[model samples]
Target chain A: MTGDTHYDLEILAELAEGLLDDATARRVREHLAVCDPCGESLADLAAVREMLAAVPVPAMPLGVAMRIDRALADEPNPFASVPVGANGLSKLSLVPALDASAEVDSEELATVTPIRRGRRVWVATLGMAAAAAGVFGASVLASSLMSAPGGTLAEPPATSVSTPERSPQRTLAYTVRASGHNYTSRELSGPLVGYFGPEPGTGSNNDEQLDACVQDKANELDRPPIAVDRAQYNGSEATVMAFWEDQSLDKVRVVVVDDNCRELRQDGLATWN
Target chain B: MTPPPEQPATPEHSAVAGARASVTDADLLARHIGGDPQAFSEIVKRHRDRMWAVALRTLGDPDEAADAVQDAFMSAYRKADSFRGDAAVTTWLHRIVVNACLDRMRRKSVRPVADDELIEAAERDTQLPDQTAEREVSMEVTAALKLLPSDQRAALVLVDMMGYSVEDAASVLGVPAGTVKSRCARGRAKLAPILSHLRNRTDLTRVSSAKGAELRDG
Candidate 1:
């Protein structure tokens, strides 16, 4: 060992960690036998490592396991019984309607079925509807009184629906449901084809008649509807649309009305609650 | 038809259970891919605690660690069919958990721990009259760990804290063995001053001396 020479701190540190090649480690050890400073540095590094090794392995938090279970339960098992389409949308049979006398609220039951379907695509339906409904209580069923005077689709605001102050419990329940069912951006378009008729036009209808129908619906509902369109609900011709009452994406108003400008029943449409 | 009466456990059932208990991780993963519903859950139950330990030490926050571990297992479950079997299942899990933790840290921009908060954490642990000396030391080590760069901390956590070999740590980090070694060296250098107090404690010093001797002889 050279009496005047000391190894670099990195080399000594590596030696301390036992990370050097056997030959390099031997050289460093021989130097350490004669060099107090290098030996002391190695000793200090070893102590640091030992102290770190002593840190407790904390028990996994209880909530983490519960959250994982919920997440896993919600996850669509690729190998499970559910059939998935080529586009990744699961083909779920329409959930059987719940008994009328069951304790489950219709809206709550409405929220539960799609979730059970385990289809990432369908989750967006409730999420979008819950977002549009905002603080409004039970969806107001609006149906178009009739087609425009000439049997053409009516203008925007076709029928009026009112926003009732919904209980906080309902809002929280819906919010919790929505948060659990996340949809991919691609799945957002799937709901459009299913709820609205093929190719629903964008940005508040350019057709004056459609605009008038939307205006009529907004005035009646007392909430402005966005993306108003002449659409179909379950093979029945209807006007389908959504509106936002607040800046939050969660606060949105959605309305579906029959061709005659009357409210549609909640059960008739798959996307609305 | 009435349901058949329940049968008591038989030698055949016990033999089946014994055989199943010896199934390898890869076999379990294969079973999951082949549509066995219980296999993946068994895998999760087996390795979750160790995965949690690696994540918690790497992230230094229980909430974030929990989130990372949960994400890792979910990803593992989803992509079980993709396992090429090139590495051990634990190694693959380590990679996933580490990546998840790093992704989370990157998303948050990993704000530096404020000096006051570090002081507060240290004071809080030390102030408890009933706190054991070992617990105090553990807390101190954890606090010191938070001071290192995330990558170095991860390497040190995997190798030093979790008792993984440097080569295994390299595989998990997706870095070379040399890189792992360098990171460990640098991390230990940085932690030395912070953990200096433990150097004087007889219990730790003796343990450290033995460990040092082992490393030197190796």
Candidate 2:
């Protein structure tokens, strides 16, 4: 029984996270239906989450941004040397070199531009010094390699320290699966209502048909439909809670299907308030 | 010269264009690549305050939130070229800010503070004039938010607090929309109970509905 209690927590966390497959989520839901302790734990954790959300964020300090601007001023563009991936970290290559001592002078811009455009500006004049440094550094590295008696000349150049070329950014796709002992709450009716984009007015509201589609998807995954408990029907939104086979935050997708059913929302866990 | 016949624009046409013009995070990013550092600044200005609020709410420390917001904007700028315009700018920015806060949390190894402790502290901090009551209400609600785990807190902040749709929030968090829906529901359910309790407390009750109207009118 003790072990089973622990097992229930494991199931609840997975269910809450929406990471479980359809069949697994279903089994957990069935268990939750019969298990009072597990159900209570889930609710308690959920309440805790809600309370934590009310915390306030303070106003941003003026100094941090000034520092960032200063850092950018002296930081040579990382793109000048390294490449980046669409989905990987880029632009940040120059960030590590951001020393607090770097001055944010307008003069640095005038000096730095000449090197890229090959103008005979003071900054370009300093390029000779940098080029010399590069040559000297390369020679030192080459000498160290050559001094190794068994070093292979045919070895490929070390590109490990260099950044890669830029590529298009990749969009992540997420899947949602829900299952639980069916409870009736008004908040759980209709299609899954989800928000999309930066602006609030741009998101979509699901009609009853969309709810049917969501239920159909759930059934297709072998999980029972989310049953409605009560509905406080407002003009556009109906607030209700439902008995899901499992209750996880991550097991839903909210999209604005165009007339052609083209999805317009980023794929991920949809929030409903 | 006669004006061209004024085309009657249908709502559908307007909707499509509106959606298109709403600029994705990737679009802003592409503009940054064209040597307009200001484009990056635009993105920063657009989401910086919201990102800061997210950090402050999750961490409950203004100084930590400041560092988090700066780091998030810098991270987004560095990774601007990687953006593909797949999600809204706000959502992507939220993800960056949340991730930065989480990273800070990991480094500091912090946990959520007790509810009563935070409530007591929040009560002490509620000192604004009655005329500015709405702002105080918002601040009060914000205090309870500090008790949630970072992930759920981020979800609730985007949904209930900021009023983002579940789908848009999912896009911002880079998760399935269904997951956002569940979290929003769970978050609201949890918040409703505590808020109901706070609604009865004397300090919070001081800001009446009439005061709320007065603040709005002012």
Clashes per prediction? 43, 64
Per-model C-alpha lDDT, please?
A: 0.55, 0.42
Q: Place model 1 in a CAPRI quality band.
A: incorrect
B125 Cα displacement, candidate 2 (Å):
11
Tens-place lDDT per residue, model 1, B87-160, is: 88878888999999989887887667765665454442122223467766776787788878889999998888
* Candidate 2 per-residue C-alpha lDDT over A70-92 given as tens digits, one digit per residue, 9 for 90 to 100: 33533434333344546544543
Q: Give the C-alpha miss distance for residue B37 in model 2, angstroms.
A: 3.6
What value does the lDDT take at residue B190 in candidate 1?
87
The count of backbone overlaps in candidate 1 is 43
TM-score of decoy 2? 0.40
What's model 1's lDDT at A98? 28
Best candidate per DockQ, number? 1
lDDT of 2 by residue, B1-218 (tens): 11112211111122223343466446656767765444565455444545655676667665566667767777766776665565556666777887888788779876556657554544432222244444445555666555555666678766655556667777777788777756654554455445544443334433323422232222
Provide candidate 2's TM-score on chain A.
0.25
lDDT of 1 by residue, A135-222 (tens): 1221221111111112344332222223233322211111101011111222222222222211100111334455556666555555
